[model samples]
Target: MSKLSLAELVSMVSETKSEGILRPTTSKDTGRYERTGLAEVVNMQITSGQFIGSRVPEPTYLPPHWSAHIHPEGQLYFCRQGSPRVVTEAYLYRPETLDKVTGWIKRIEKLIADQDFPVSAELELFIKLEDEDCAYYLTISAFLPSFRFRSSTCFARNCIGTMSNFFPMHGSLSRGTLDSLVCVFMHAICDQMTSRVSTFPYSKQDCEAFVSLLKNSRDHLSDGNIVCTVARLWGIICRNRYLTQYGQENSRLSRDQAVLWDPETKNRWVSTVASRISFRTSDRYLAQLDDVFVDHLVYSDQWKSMVTGCLRDWRGASHGAFLALMLHIFLLALTPCPSLAVASASLFVASLLASTLLLNRYVPLQGVTAEQAMDYLEAVQSPTFKFQFVALVFALPHTLNLWGTLVLFANCIFMLATNFGTGFAAGISTVALLAFIAFQWTTSDRFNLSLARTHDKFRAMFFRNPDASYTSEV
Candidate 1:
């Protein structure tokens, strides 16, 4: 028998993938352009068909620390993440071009580094956005050190609080929060010379990263380079507006429309992004991107494959949390075995506390003020979880069977306390994993502060009744 060549094997695989089982007859799996062919168009250019040159223009000397945080995604941008934090008053209703807004942002970042904002600077600017950390993302990134906020969606500060809630980890939330100061407050703020810090909730990574991605170019971006590149990317997206699912009033431009930066599309895109200066004065610009398209097209990635990946991660997180919850209840049932009960309860309660705190942080509540945001932060910063742990313990046991469970619960808590010393190292790792997974699982919007959806999800999960899938715009 003749051995099959590599080419033959690949051809077979490609054919099989094209003919997806039970796929609609209308589907054309074997289109002329294959995945690799499309990738070549987006990622690589040919040098006389001999050598493949990268289409992306990334910088070469990226710091060792920053290397890991970089995601070299192409054909899309992170702006589509839909503004995770709060977009404060300054940016709203300001008909500023992308050039003007980005210039202002750069000025702020530069001033922050210099630590000296001149009196002339109208400096107070904030783009507040909210982000939900979810399960699959956290689990995948769990092994990083205490500063895992970027590497994992897990907030390191929560590890101690969650762990101490059930098992009394010798570590304090104050210390954990303090220790993770770099990740929480200082990651992306570093100079280009510093090691790269990972940015989490990947969708909302700074425009610096998005700039490199849009160029299909090198890593190790400078501030100037990032601005110019991102400006161009924004321009390109505008040029290709018809391609987007976003409904433009006149979707078809006859290569003659003069809007948003310049008479020609190419000039319009690049003119706004200035690396060395503040917002440039310009006349021709689009009136507004349709508000209806903002969430999906303007602020979020609209790719099908990426969309599918999101759903998968969302479900994984939810299931992971549900599993942890079930295990907690199971351990409650096993309270007769003090050692076993204490160990299992530690995992569940830690996860429960972590999820609760994440909910408090991300889910918006009516009438929230900046003061309340501070209050939330301070509450999480507390060094001890003893009160929370004891309160939770007292609440759960009596609901099952008053007398026997009460006795078992008392014995377990007592034994746990007597045996517990600050198991700081052990506590951090355990709770970090559990909290990361549980928090990510719970924060997806369907069940996140969404009363009706949360109700349906729990009922379906526990009662064998199913509900329609919920997908959020952000």
Candidate 2:
């Protein structure tokens, strides 16, 4: 206001010009400047080189098919789309860590996209924040026209390669250590082979035995050698899976047949015939058998119980048949004038003996392993094997028991006719006939009802139709 010199006048004019110009405001001055205006000012300053060393906020990046999340403790993680449970194991704190994760995702995506056919890929990554070591696993599985292809890559601190490269650090391994490793590997293989979707039907015990034989060989071998052998076994299983898938798609085999068939297709025909004959078997027995086949490891306890119960029942029936056969033979010897009654007695006696012999020969005395049981079942159900022959052999003891009792009754009636008067014999025969008819009527009604209930249950189990009715026509 008191400027009188030329310099003072110039200073005042400069101040007025500065006051007229709009000054940029900080973010705190929201009342005067909006956020957009403030952002524009900052961008202008940065472009004009006025805001030296100032960092602009970085644009966020997220992986495709995955979502990035910040944990409560400031760790970053990524979850797969629609699958929150499937998250990255590596924690992201630095830009390098994020870059590594991104690289892995890109690599797997590229691999999946490059395949000629549809396939599945799984990736696992583990990173240590404090150490330089990292581990990653990638598994790619596909079903091809000729075979199943599976590539498992593992990168660890000590080793970097496929599953075939997994070996002890030392060239040699102790027998016990090798056995343990083999057991672990075999268990994993068995789990995959025995899974619901898997077509390989070999049991865990079978895999273990096959691997154990290789381990126990006297030839000097390294850890790598044993690992290679295990890898070969895994390849075989994959090949089998491919074959089964091909058969299911190209042939008329049922799912079970496709899964359980041998390489030559003989087992397929056998399984078909067995399925047809299975309808005639006891529903409870058939159900147990199916359960064992579905998951032998899970149903092994049930199998043991079934086998023990069947053995007990068969043994008791065999004893009864043997006694009945002896009694009938004695009766035949005692009869002087052997009529058709004697012939009936003789035939029943022969049947009883045959049933007893079959029971003794075919029935196992001790409990067998699940693998053995499955083998026995497969053998019995073979196409070359006669279903009627097995049915007759198994049913003879019980069937002959009833027939033997009737034959004895007939022999007694014939003896009465020979020794006693005709009127007395006729009266006895009439009474016996009435009793037999009543017994048969009562028992047959119950049996038919039970059979109908069993049929309904079987239908419900296999057909999944609970509302359907199964009733005898009477």
Candidate 3:
């Protein structure tokens, strides 16, 4: 395949009106360009083609090697999966020229890194916008490890009271959050010489291995030549999940799928990603990216197919269900009958809970055959077949039987009023008041405090003992 010069590729993207972010990795030989670092573009390049002999001066608004079309004023977003802190928004800059904007972004990255921001100084490029209002925000809002938050009093912190609910590993919510994290982690580990101690707790094995790898890289090259090893690692994860869908082993696990990322084999992966697929960068300067390197980074022969496939699947699966459920809930609210409305409300709440649990359970099992897992999940969650019961107690006159009696009594009073009986209206009024009071008392949350307490206490006992390990161990 003919390799594309950066300018030719940029020209093509400009012509196509593609929406993407260009991310390039730093290399040793890049000089003044090095300070320009990574850049973000919005939409497609406003213009393209070689500037070497062209009378037109290189567009000052354009970043050096990266371009994309995004709202220049929007915040820069950063994320990583499995890390305690995932989602972040950086200030966006609108520069006089696209190139200047790109330079400023790189400078900001260096500035942030120097300031000791928790995030890596390294660059990532992105240029995606939410197509519509969504109920679920998918970015690494879920999988971030503990300690990211300063207080446990906020709504999200309170919701994450237990670790089980902390990460929605699988489900529609997984991708925007977890996938971003995965990419972030790979970029940090591979491109930056950060250690686990400064950020996350790491095992000695991984730390030593990584340090040794870094040392070896330093020995082999200088002008800032970092190997694409980290990119290769990312390719492995992405491809395994994407191409062979090994991660979807529950559905298919053919030998073809398993062949996606075997570094040990003769099938050495190539870095030809941008050649095969269309990609663009964001204009958000803080999300610095180098287009040329990003092309190479994403185009690992070892796992390019898998990464692209994963993107397709993640996007398709994430947004569709979120939209459907939001619509369903909105529609359900229009129903009229109070009793029916209450029932629908209960159903909605139950459905939401069930979805959360199911998503949590599916995350870790992505790479495994899910026959037994699915069976277990179904068996445990099958409401119809599960042996369970609910007892509802109604106060006097509010009970189904009592309510029927009141209806009959009211009818009798109306019938008798036509005949005789002084003070009949008063009697009927008293009965009605008594019935209302009784009904209210029975359903009152205050009356159910004990029941709520019992449920809470029971769950509390199992709080730290997720997986029911205590029961088995005991």
Candidate 4:
């Protein structure tokens, strides 16, 4: 097997983008590369289907609503040594998981915490994988998942120099990797997943998953979880590889990644060792994770971010208004262009009104009277920025020219109606004004308005605040 330093490898190839606490994968078809560092060793195979044995027709563990997006295929797997029954969750093998171990440990730790420990829980320790399935009757007591091992969860999320603490074997591969085959399997899942997210990466939905995962974990975005999650994600974005099936004599590409496998192939690496710990493991564990993936974990406050972003845009727009005010003042004092002066002054007044409305909507009354604060809280609790108003406000900024045109048409219509009695020009002018109004209505609604305020479609899409209850305007 060829040995190369990471520094040397980086010079040849590049990494893909990653989210928090996950390692970045490399560019696909960009030639073979292996990542090995201080104390980083894994038992993997670089063979033509020799190491990972044949397929099983049935799945070892199948949860309801399990999709390829979770565990590519469902079947039982045997480890190189003993092939002890492997029990795992699909999220543990999901491709977008920035840090697989972070999610995995979180899921397990929560399980451990809730359980009545020392009384063999129906759980499997990932550390061991014997050849025969159920040949070893191990209990929750057999697993040494104490709070002391929490540090290792932190270690798994970290990259490079920090990882040495987990393995601590700065040695040659000829003696084999530091961890067992099962450890290699888990790390392989992480490595495979990073490649998919990093290389062809796009959109907030792509990377925001890491944020949700970290938040949902037992640490619940604890300081260490956040830090390590960041490290792993950045590492993946920067295209870091793991040495899972590396240093093999043949040097072929490792087909161990679950992401690349077809359903049949994916199913073969199937066995997951689940605890018969109780009804919790057998019945509710899968449902609980399902809840997190579908609903609870996705619970976040998007309204806060949306409001803050809109405020920032408005603040910038305010500067433009200030400039317009100055221009109006200059024209009014120095220039002979009275029409332009009048128009500019009118614009300045309208801007001030708009700003005041926004300010009042956002800020509470300065006075500390009991009523004012209560009113403020009440206003906040009940959203005043209904979809139509939001649309109108956003549309209002771009409507200056349209309003100007409409005003000119109205003036013509008024003069004609007063003298000419609905003559040709007056009729045409009225039509023009109506057309402009129609245009504004359609354009604004297209961007921000939701016609059915009862359901609050737009607000639900863009104005969700987890803490605030939404009462429909309709």
What TM-score does prediction 4 earn?
Answer: 0.24
lDDT of 4 by residue, 161-276 (tens): 12211111111121111122223334444544665322111224543454455334434332333333433343332222232223444321432222222222132111122212
Candidate 1, residues 117-140, lDDT tens digits: the string is: 222211112222112110011111
What digit string (tens of lDDT, one per residue) describes model 3 on residues 368-474? Answer: 32234334334432234121111011011012222333333444454446445648766776887899888877787986997788877887787776457657777
Per-prediction TM-score:
0.16, 0.35, 0.17, 0.24
What lDDT tens digits, residue by residue, belong to model 2 across residues 244-287? 45445453222233244433333345435544443323334444
Q: What residue pairs clash in candidate 2, if any at all?
A: none
Off by over 4 Å in 1: 1-301, 334-415, 420-474
Error (Å) of candidate 1 at residue 302 is 3.0
Q: Rate the local accuracy (lDDT) of all candidates.
A: 0.31, 0.47, 0.32, 0.34
Ranked by lDDT from best down, the candidates are 2, 4, 3, 1
RMSD of each: 31.5, 29.4, 26.1, 26.7
Model 3 segments more than 4 A misplaced: 1-61, 69-107, 116-407, 410-474
Query: Whose TM-score is higher: candidate 1's or candidate 2's?
Result: 2
Q: How many clashes does each candidate structure show, in the order listed? A: 28, 0, 42, 33
Between candidates 1 and 3, the TM-score winner:
3
